[model samples]
Target chain A: MTALTSAVTAPGVLGRSRALVRPALKEAVGRMHPWVGEMAAYSFGWCEVGGGPAVASGGKGVRQALAVLGAEAAGAPGRAGVPAAVAVELVHTFSLLHDDIMDGDAARRRRPTVWKAYGTGPAVLAGDGLFALAVETLAGTSAGPAALRLLSASLGDLVRGQADDLLFATRPWAGARRVRPGEYLAMAEHKTGALLGCSAALGAVLGGAPPAVVTGLDRAGRHLGVAFQIVDDVLGIWGDPEVTGKPVHGDLREGKKTYPVLAALDAPSPATAHLVTVLESAGDPAVAAALIDEAGGRTAALAEARRHVAAAEAALAGLPIPAGAADDLRSLLDFLVCRDL
Target chain B: MTALTSAVTAPGVLGRSRALVRPALKEAVGRMHPWVGEMAAYSFGWCEVGGGPAVASGGKGVRQALAVLGAEAAGAPGRAGVPAAVAVELVHTFSLLHDDIMDGDAARRRRPTVWKAYGTGPAVLAGDGLFALAVETLAGTSAGPAALRLLSASLGDLVRGQADDLLFATRPWAGARRVRPGEYLAMAEHKTGALLGCSAALGAVLGGAPPAVVTGLDRAGRHLGVAFQIVDDVLGIWGDPEVTGKPVHGDLREGKKTYPVLAALDAPSPATAHLVTVLESAGDPAVAAALIDEAGGRTAALAEARRHVAAAEAALAGLPIPAGAADDLRSLLDFLVCRDL
Candidate 1:
């Protein structure tokens, strides 16, 4: 298949996907939660009746793209990936909803976060509903046993990753030290990579790809997930506020022990000392940003993120897909991990 | 099958269930959020491994038992309900973990609560793990489509009910003020009944019982769940400390809007005024208990529970099964909704 135009590739896939996903997502929402239209519209950055743009934001739908791409790569030709993509997206939505609540995050997609808008109770309930809807939808898939296992295992990782994140958050002992690159990669893999892996895995499985091909796609997804996370970490700390729709140095302000801080900590500098003290102090964002910059933390963090992205790109070398498909996938990875948004 | 004598029955079904449930529950604890175990252990009445003779301290294990019994009633026969039972219990455990944290309740099953034993973060993660594990286990169950659907929908209700409960707590508006008995029943049915329904439903589906039988069993489970919650409400107010292991009028102390309180609220009087005032007020448990008695709320709650028990009994009528099995089920309901401990 010819590679779609660069500008249109993602939007094109999402546009096609929205057609399939919209109705299923709507029905699933109804089945799973009350005030479904309102919550979903608010979540998707659409008005209650899809009236207009609810927010100036949304994801590139990369994971759903993986599900779609995996199915194509596995030779299920036309849109067999639709159902799997919807299910994967639902799980992703669920994770985002709950994670925001747990972290007390107040914004998403340049708008009030689910918990912030609807309160924690509704946010949690909506998340749970999405989770159930994901599983229920997966069970309905024609891909059958393999699809079931893939989705279930992915759900497990989602929880386990969440557990690790929460554990890392509260356990001073666990997170006190700066994160090593390897450890950071592993955390990223668990926290984000696993679901992407499931996305590709489901696509491959449902599309009837050979076992080795399935394995290759899974690895590709893991690498992609890690890369995505590292990029996210970079954006979290230093991305332009206009593009990212978040304050610069947000992570430092939150005292988040992301890759750069962890890397910097290992160098045994006074900055590390100042940083720790700053994190302990709970100052305003300006103070936190000043401290982080003074420490030269942002550049170091970006370098670490770059290293992970390089590694992720290297993992894609083994896939035997057609050249255009491979390039599209590569471009997608770069777009995700390097974009301003 | 011949009816087992009560002497024989005590150690037969109940005894074996204890044996089955104990080890599984242990394994579950071992595997959950590692941070949450200390708190969870305390809530489960363990100071350490092999801690004090495992208190008959846990609930009737009604949720789990319903799964087990449902399996039999539905015909997957011996022990097929175990997985579903385990899953339902995990859901139950999840609720309790969060409920304690939410209510700031300091004790459970006669021991320090999860949040009390460990801390809020660990407690929340622990509860979250249990919720994850519930679906995780069901993924491994032998019951095909039906069981999966049953379990997923059950979990959906459990979360939604929790949301409702939380919403009610935060906003006690007129709807909340005049909370009808039916609404209370609906709440309990959703919060409590749904899980139990899944339990029984799993059994019937796995057991290969006909669809009608499964439907009948589901209705019975709903009645049983309502009966259980009402009974629990009664125990919360006036049951013996030795038997209940919780503080007398503990629900009232927490100002939980249970069925009895709602019933009295509907027909306002000096008693209802006092009861409502105490619930709306913030003070000591002793003061609250005194107000409950002054309002004649305790007796009314108990009477209401008995009414529910009778309704529960009526729902079990004409279930297609051997007389002895039906009798055992009836006795089991009594053991569930009527038992002191």
Candidate 2:
């Protein structure tokens, strides 16, 4: 790793990415009907619930950062990845807006979710608008076709993941219908990994990278996504409310089929039986949380997350890119996986 | 018009389009999660609300037929246009699925709407799935990038049109906020015409036509869409329930800002004031409908429809296609504008 790569922190890479992507995204949003635009602005954390300016800005730009980094790794300037950055970010926002409505979530990032802030219809349309822009953003560019194929396939995986998650809600906690551990992992990979994979691939492709390099970056991002999702799942179950800005044991209370719960349920420990009973009977969420911990769910989940991260790291090692960019990429992935709630 | 053109009836053109597009459409839907696939099947009229195979096999396939014909007009075989046909049809289905949920509509094509049959969340996913497939269908083909760009822009127009329609619901029947006549027509063009325009353009592009011919065909479709929309507006108000499969005066009852009502409100006749009073006071829908008619709203709307149809015919006359295809195109447009509810 070069001194410049060491000096360039994760936040710096992310800031640079946002600098390039935000303007294009803003222009796209500005072109929408004023009503839908308001909802989209609110979803992006740029406005208050009732439509005034907000200071919070938006997401951490993880996908956008990855896109920029992927470009840099391909020996192109980060600006070369702006279209992919904008597109992936747009898709991420679209998914978040719709998911909030589908999951009946009221709050996110310590603020009201888009559906809760606006009406469900408006939120849905806003999400659709963002999606439309995402596709247009790619198709309007010279490098659009390949990236669009990646995006289209990712959408299928996303819907499949969401569908499986919704279906899991109806399955019994302690019967043959109970979701399996491998099923939970597959869902996580599909729901979260696919977009991350696409973002990396799209960026490299946009940066004029060859197909082999794009495929390698895609694999790295996918593994990293699974690791990141596991961290999120853990936070949902046991993170500090003040830090996560979320209620404690939310996954348990909502009966979410998360990684930790599935891992514990698959454990050979006797505590697994008690965990199922608590979940099935709709008992105290805290009790279920404790039983899951006692059954080694926490350690198992963390271990699984580490394994994926290792896989991501291995994928990154073979990439023929600037060694400095590769180091920065590893550091960024590490930060994502090891972040606090 | 050539003899072959005269012999090719609207139904024949539509039937051939369906025969080519349906199998492709079926295969795409089959790729989704089974739960979402069921809802999509229901939306396409391939299945009942509860999931059994149904007698009703879907929409009129007018967009698909236009796509096929557009390709033929570009001097290519109709089969070359199947990708565009499928893509446009997919986008149409996507709009309908989301629109049903947004509009709170209960029935379409004499069956329960997707959201009404399944839950809103499931229907939303199903719409998104169709949208995903639409993009993929384009991107997977050689003619993808340009067609995808057209589709993306059309989505923006479609959303803008819908947003305007939704916003109009909050406007007063008799005040400064009353929807303007020009605004309503623009909204109608956006909501009803954009995808139609895209369908024609996409087909010609897929058939290897140059950009100028694509633009001309797009304009023709746009005019036809406005004419088709006006006819639909009239049917909503006055068409027999048995034929239309809709409640009588549904637009008035639902306070829809349709072309006829906007025309009536804009008229110089004294009866316009009475119509406004009836609408604002929430008086009987039938009374409002009759007053709107008495003010010549129906005549005005039909006249507007005829003008658009004429515009469409004029645009088609300049096309560089085989004369037979042009004649067939005009005949199809005529059938769409002239059909009974």
Q: TM-score for all predictions? A: 0.80, 0.96
lDDT by residue for model 2 (A273-320), tens = 889889988899989988989999888999999999889888989879
What's the number of clashes in each of the models?
A: 6, 0
lDDT for position B250 in model 2: 80
TM-score of chain B of each: 0.80, 0.95
Whole-model Cα lDDT of every candidate shown, in order: 0.67, 0.85
DockQ of each: 0.31, 0.75
Give candidate 1's error at residue A10 in angstroms: 2.8
lDDT of 2 at B162: 87
Give one digit per residue, the lDDT tens place, for model 1 in A71-95.
7777675267767887888888878
Model 2 interface CAPRI class = medium
The per-prediction CA RMSD against the true structure, in angstroms, equals: 5.3, 2.4
Predicted structure with the largest TM-score when compared to the true one: 2
Which lDDT value does model 2 have at A304? Answer: 92
Name model 2 segments beyond 4 Å from true. A1-8, A339-341, B1-8, B339-341
